[model samples]
Target chain A: MDMRAAVFRGPGEIAIEDVPKPALDAPTDAVVRVTHTAICGSDLWPYRGQEDRDVPSRIGHEPMGIVEEVGEEVRSVAPGDRVFAPFVTSCGECEFCRKGLHTSCVNGGFWGGEDGGAQGEYVRARHADGTLVRVPDRHADDEETLQAILPLTDVMGTGHHAAVSAGVDAGSTCIVVGDGAVGLCGVLAARRLGAERIIAMGHHEDRLALAESFGATDTIAARGEEAVERAQELTYGGANHVMECVGSTGAMNTAIEVCRPGGTVGYVGVPHGIEDDGLDIFGLFMDNISLNGGIAPVRAYADELLADVLGGTLDPSPIFTKTVDLDGVPEGYRAMDEREAIKVLVKP
Target chain B: MDMRAAVFRGPGEIAIEDVPKPALDAPTDAVVRVTHTAICGSDLWPYRGQEDRDVPSRIGHEPMGIVEEVGEEVRSVAPGDRVFAPFVTSCGECEFCRKGLHTSCVNGGFWGGEDGGAQGEYVRARHADGTLVRVPDRHADDEETLQAILPLTDVMGTGHHAAVSAGVDAGSTCIVVGDGAVGLCGVLAARRLGAERIIAMGHHEDRLALAESFGATDTIAARGEEAVERAQELTYGGANHVMECVGSTGAMNTAIEVCRPGGTVGYVGVPHGIEDDGLDIFGLFMDNISLNGGIAPVRAYADELLADVLGGTLDPSPIFTKTVDLDGVPEGYRAMDEREAIKVLVKP
Candidate 1:
């Protein structure tokens, strides 16, 4: 079957092409007919070849789709099921999966491309039974509104995980470093978790505005040391929870600087190695601050977050400030990479 | 009342001087007749005048004594009660107390020296109800055997808290950095917590051997990166939990470095103004290793550890390698600071 697909020919290049549809490869596998896919800031990483794009591989990991085909082993879902796929596909049985740490599952890999990314029309999801969460049928017809749920597949879940890992709780002050979609989502997660104060650090006013909408009680546009001091001022010394969403040396430094003594810094940002100054370890050790966060266990929070979306208790859509057709996927990547949008929704 | 006390009349000069007996000041305070006190590694920090010693305060914080007098407000312990005093005196009603973080309680303060150190015949212990844990009456007669328990007042409790804070549990592997008494105690604590594997890292053969006796399954006599690599090799990559008990920047770094992805480094080491490399925020972000620990909530773990000592479930006494009369207290400090003794017990 010929399916319209967004093909990444190379870095900074994308073209609409007719690609062969995905099929059931294993008894636990399922083929999701793409209904909604979202452009993630992470997507920009590979799109710009900054993440060492495995050439010719489809590149997207946030999508909601209809279960057009279900393997025989699948029991939780069936054909015609509306579902949201977790970014990383995991086998139901594994040490990591047993502990609900799906991202680190030995037998599980991500979805979406040939390497299991989600940029194409038809995407194969391995370990379909444990990795896919059924979406409500009501939101199926409103793909635009429901499209926002796609980011929850990775970004929203990631942000929530950051807050949870950092031990953000009621009465705690939280600080989210970076103004990207994940950072904004972190602010939302902090608010939902009942953080008394949420400080969103960003250099962009527009992004800061979006962060405010996502429940950031305060925003600091400063970078580096100044940014940390501003967060400290807002939180009456330093934040109890610091979420590092931007994967950079500076953002990492900001997290440590802004977290209070006896607080925790949950970092989900993938770091590019930087030299050790010996100060971070000293602060972490002396202050009793817990630093914890990594790959998001998307499946862990999928059901709860999806229920929130269906009931309208939470709106993650504000992060989607731009949208583009599958054919214009390259431009969407450019917009996100250039900071033109917090997140861009892609229509398949 | 005249009492024989180890007095630091001046730097490099300490003599067993006859001093006035201690008195109870607050209603919740108690005056303990010190049966045994410990010369802690920290005690030397001031004894050598490396720390402020101008006030000529008492020089010991680790001690086991009999409650000679109890103020009117004292409820938990009365006169004649045999007790172990936690180094940090806490008011059980404070916010930190409610959360079982007694070491950092709002009204919590260190014992010994300026206020009331245990290096004397009689010592005043403030917040008696919160700061003192009455030992089982059975062990009250065995002062020598229980002298080992003296270190539990500070070092042992601190190590145990380090393990607990890092979330060490059954089937987990842990690395203990530093071979001091506290680090060895941490090894014992990790073992009691059901950790399957414990790696003790130190440079001295004697200390490493002591660590093994304390329940360290393996020993790595290396420092810095080599130490970390040795621990990782012993643990088959890395440990699930790392306890940093040395209270140095180097130990903290080693603990963080040896922890596995998704592991946690519980650091009880009192850091000097030295900065960490921010490994907790940046380097460990992708590894998902959390850095957690600070001043251990010694009050929280004292009862159980004390029980372990009484029940023969744990023998923490080997750490008390030497015992001296009040007159030899200065030599005890020298032994510990010079890395000659694991822990020195001082009897007044």
Candidate 2:
């Protein structure tokens, strides 16, 4: 049986192609029929040729779906259940996983390549018992609730990671870098974590408005040094917690500069220019600033964030400015790459 | 009318010059008679011309002495009392100082240049009440007690900073990178913090033994990759806590590679090669490794460490492998630079 999936044909090209549907390849695996997926900011990396992607390669990692079949060893998730998984799949039993570092789980792997891409109709989840999170049975059919929770599969959890890693807490001040989907969610995460002041730094007006709605107390439509200087002035010589969600050298530098003495810069953006520009270690050292976070272990944060989503206290659906079907997957990529869409939500 | 102080005449040259004695320059200043001070590894930076310094400038920072005079505002110490100050001076009442980040204190400054070098017969202490820690009156004249507590002015407290920054705790495994005085003290600090296993890495045989005496459970004499591999093997994969006591880029890389995912590398070595080599941020990001700490904020950690020193549970006097009087200061610098002595104690 064949299923349609998004494939990278070449730079500036995404194609909807037919591929063999995934099946239970291991005792701990489960085949999930994807009901929801999305084109992430990172997805644009390969789509724009900023990063290399093999021709005809499966793409996408975010997935929220229904379990189609479960192998004998799959216990926590069964067929017919509505579930979601983080960008990275983990056995959830490794030492690192036990400590909430699922990104470093010894037995975890990413979706795509030999495995079915999450942007496909069906994908096999490795370590099903430890990977899939069920949405309780009642809320499974609620479209509004589902949209609110779907982002928890990636961006929302990741944003929470940035905030948590940066030490955002009640009554504290937090400045989030980037205006991307992840950064928008970070503003919400800071608010959720009770940060009294949330400063969002980015140059987009529409996105900045969305950020304010998501509880950002202030916004800086500036770039580079000016953005950093503005953040410092707003927070009175930098804040104790600064979240770097853009992963570029400039963003990292801004985060470091906007961090007060003894403060922390929690960065989750996939580093882009570090190989050439390098991080400012001396500047960080002299100020006694700390560098924390990496590829956030999103699965570790799924539970708390999902609870908030289900409780109606948190919603990040506003980040999805465009929607598409399987046939529009190619356009989805184009819209996001062109900045015509904040994030593209897919339903197949 | 004049007091002799160590002056850096040029790279690789030290001069004992008769400089004018310091007096109370501010209401918060105190003049101290240097009874004991030590040559620090960082002192060699300017001496070797690795870092530029003013020619013929008064040098040295580590100081433990008797308070000879106090400004009207000096409340923490008085005339005839013995006191030790950290390399950096801080007003204890500042927000950073109150939070134990005295190095970043808004009202703090380093201990050289116009302030009068610590390696002098009489020098002034700025913010005396905040910068000076007074030794109990009964133990002031006791040579053995004084020697043990003297290191708290610098190395011992710095080592404690490394350990504390690295999150060393009871039953944890810690790796101390370097075998310098600070590194040896780091081993003691790890033991003090209750680390079950302490690995000291360096190529020096004698220093390794000293580290062992200070509570290193194992030692690796290999350099670079081999050392990282050995540390990994010892910790099964990599340790959760690694103290980087060497400021070289090579040492920083080793610390990163030897840290487990979700672990932190607490670094206190003055960052030396970062400008050219830069830090491995991508490597650090890949493992979720956190880089914590910078220049040791010894003042922040002084009281607790001093309590242990005075209590006799901790004695770092052994780090001072050789002792010299006022006239032997130049030779003291040469001995340390040539590795003939681990650290040189000076009685000015």
Candidate 3:
């Protein structure tokens, strides 16, 4: 059988081409017919020629679909079930997975692993029982509800990880660096976690409005020292917690500078050009600050966020400012690259 | 009045010279007659020419003495009371002080601040009520008890800070990097906090033996990758907490590598030449490790440690392996610099 999927030819080049249809090759695997997918900020690393990539490789990780087939051993999910597959797959039984750090699961791997990617019409997901979360039958045909739940695969969960790592809770004063989709989600997570005050730093007036809507108490459209000064002024010194969602050196430094003594900075941006000399170890030590964070364990947070989505308590679909068909995946990447869209969703 | 004190003449040079005796200069100040003082690892930074110093400046911070005079506003201690001044002075009313982060107190200053240094016959102490802890009268005349209490001003307290910041508890498995006095003290601190297992990494057999005496369950006589491998082998993967008492880049890296996913690295070494690139941000983020710690809040930990000393529970005096009279102050620095003494006790 043949299927249509997005393939990466090189930097700035993505194409929808004919590819082999996915099949349940293992007893723990399930094949899902792709229904919706979204572009991520992380995808830009290779799209912008910043990271090397192998030509003709499968692309994309976030996807929601209807399971078309399941191996005999797959007991939790079956054909005809609507579901969301997190960016990473996990076995659900490893020490790390059992501890709720599914990203570090010993036997788990990324979606585009050897077989194919999620941008295709069908995806073969391994560790099926542990990797896929079932969508309610009530929302099976609701496009808006599906769009709202799609981001839980990566962005929403990543933001929640940042908040959790920084120890954000009731009465916490927080500063979020970056105004991207993930940064906006961070504002939502901080509010959900009961932060007393949240200051978001971003340059886009439009995104600043979105951030305020998502629960940011204040916004600073500045960078570097000016941003630090504005955040400090708002918090009366510096915030007790900071979320760094942009991986640039300046963004990391500004995040550190705006945190109070004995505070924590939770960083989630995938490091690309980060260098050792760009960090201020002496300053961090002198101020007694903690630097904590890593890749989000999206699989661990999926079910909880899906609950919020199904309960109608959260609506993250606004992040999808643009929509495209599978054939427009190339233009979707370009739109995100040019900052013309916060995020792009695709209906296959 | 004239009093003899240790004065820094230049790199690698020290002298016992006559300086003006200290007097109460502010309502919150007190004058202390020096009884016992000790050298610190930080002092070696300047003494070894690794860092610049202002020549003719008084040298020394860790000191225990008898309060000879107090300003009318000082209500905590009066004339003739035995006391020890924390290395850092803090205004009790500052937000940081109220949070028990006295090291970062808004109105705080180090020991050698306008007043003459602690290695003198009499020294002026600012914020006396907040920085000076009273010694019980029963142990006032015991020289051995006084020696044990002196380290509470810096080294012992710094080690305690490392343990606390790393969340060390009864069942935690830990690692202590560095074999100097501070590292040895870290072993003691971890054990005091009820850590189940502690692996101390050091190069010297003698220091390793001291680490064992201080409660290290295992010792790795290796450095760098080898040290990390050994620690991993012992802990199955990595330790729950790591104490980095050496400020070198390699020591910090080794500490980070030997910590388990989700563990904390408590670093208290005064960073000298650490750079940003030396850290593995991608790896740290992926593993969810936290880098926490800074200068010890000596004032905050002083009273509790003093209780241990008076109750005959902790004996940190073995760290003071060599003793020097007031006139031999210069030799004390030489002994510590040459590694001929673990620490030097100065008696005036």
Candidate 4:
């Protein structure tokens, strides 16, 4: 069988191509019909030529869909079950997976590697039992509910991981660095974790407003030293918890600078220019600022975040400001990269 | 009156010179006649010409002494009280201090600046009530008790900070890097915190032996790649809690390399060549390793560690392998620089 999938040709180029449709290649694998997918800020890295990638690579990772077929070993989801997989697939019982570090699972892999691209009609999930999350059948046809929980496959769980790493607790103050979907999700996650003061730093006025609605007590559209000063002034020195959603060296430094002594900076930002510039580690060591977080173990947090979404208490759907079909994925990438869209959702 | 104090003549030189005796300089000041002091690994930076400093400057910060005089506002101790001061003098009531970040206290200053050098017979204490911790009158004149508590002024407290920063918990495993007095004390601290397994890494055989007595379950004196391999082999990948007590760039890298995913590296090492070599922050991010710790908040941990010391469960005094009188201050520097002594104890 053949299916339409988004393929990355090179920088600034994504194309729709007919690729082999995902099938249950292993007993632990399940084939999914992707009803929804998303264009992430991370995707823009390759599109903008900031990160290197092999040409003709399968594109996209976040996927929400129906299980088209499941292998004999896939027990959790049956055909026609509405399911979503995390950014990475992993064997449920690996030492790391058992310890909630699924990102480091011994048998884990990304969606666009051996599996079909997420922005496709069909995708394959390896280690299906450990990777797939089933939504209640009652919400199978609910478009509103599906839209609300789509970000949970990546950004929401990632934001929650940032909050957890930063030690955001009841009555704690926090500063979220970035204006992207993940950063907005961080504000929501901080709120969910009972943070009393969520100060958001971003450059977009519209996004800053969105952050406030997402439960940020304050928002500042500043960069560099000014951003640090404003955040510190608001927190009466610096916030104890900071989230770095942007991977730039400047964002990392701001996250650290706005973190108070004995505080923590939870950074889920994938390093961009860090290899070239390095981090101000001596500064981090001197100030007692704990730098925590890396690639979020998004799978480990799925159940809890899904529960919140199902309960109708969490809504991250507003981040999907643009919608597209499989053919629109190239445009989706362009929209996100040009800041014309906060995040683009694809209905395949 | 004049007091003999150790002064930094430059790299590879320490000279004892008579300086005017310290007196109460502020309303909160206390003048202490030094009874005991010790050389810190940090002090060697200037002695080895690794760190820049003004020549002929006063040296030494850790001091245990008898309070000879007190200004009117000093409420914690009166004349004739036996006390010890942390490396940095902080006004305990400051925002950072009240939260147990005394090292970042707004009114904090180092002992050898403005105040008198701790290596001198007399040193003036600023923010006396907040900076000085008094020993019980019963144990005041006991030589054994005095020696047992002297390291609390610096190394012991420092090691304790590392354990706390590393989040050492009951039934956890830990790896302490370095064989200095602080590293030995870190082994003790981890044991005190109920870590089930403690691995000590260093280059010295005698110090590793000391670490064993201090509760290290394993000791590996390897460096670089071999060090990482041996530690990983012993720890089943890597321990979740690693304490970097050695300030060298190589030690920091080893600490990071040996920390497991979702683990933390509690670094108390005053970074030596990090500015030049830089840290592999991207690697840390990729591994999900958290970097926690800075200059230890020694004063913040004094009370709890002191109680443990007085309870006969902890004995870190063994780290002081050699003791010298006031005139042996120059030799004390040489012995530590040459690693002839784990730490040098000075009595004036």
Ranking by DockQ: 2, 3, 4, 1
- Which pairs, if any, clash in model 3? A276-B276, A276-B277, A277-B277, A294-B285
| CA shift of B55, model 2, Å | 3.5
User: What docking class should model 4 receive?
Assistant: medium
Summarize candidate 1's per-residue lDDT along A39-126 as a digit string, tens digits: 7776666676766766666678876788888789999888888887887887768766777677767777766454334766778778
For each candidate, give its TM-score against the true structure: 0.74, 0.95, 0.96, 0.95
What fraction of the real A-B contacts shows up in model 3?
A: 0.74
- Tell me how far the alpha carbon of residue A1 in candidate 3 is from the true structure, in angstroms, after superposition: 4.9
Residue range B182-247, candidate 4, lDDT tens digits: 899999999999999999999989999999999999999987899899999999999999999987
Q: Where in model 2 is the C-alpha error above 4 Å?
A: A9-11, A52-56
lDDT of all predictions, in order shown? 0.77, 0.90, 0.87, 0.90
Worst 10 residues of 2 chain A by lDDT: A273-282
- The interface RMSD values of the models, given in order, are 3.5, 1.3, 1.8, 1.5
Per-model B-chain TM-score: 0.92, 0.98, 0.97, 0.99
lDDT of 3 by residue, B1-348 (tens): 888998888889888888888788999999999989988888888989887889878989987899999998999999999999878888888899998899889987887735878877778888889888898888888988988898998999998888887888998899999988889889999999999998999988888899999899999998768878999999998987999988877788788888888788999988876674366766677788788898888788888888888898888888888999888778889999999898999887
Cα-based lDDT at residue A213, candidate 2: 98
Q: By DockQ thresholds, what CAPRI class is model 1?
A: acceptable
Tens-place lDDT per residue, model 2, A23-111, is 88899999999999999998888887888878889988999999999999888988899999999999989998899999898999889
State the DockQ, from 0 to 1, for candidate 1: 0.34
Residue A114, model 2, lDDT: 62
- lDDT of candidate model 4 versus the reference: 0.90
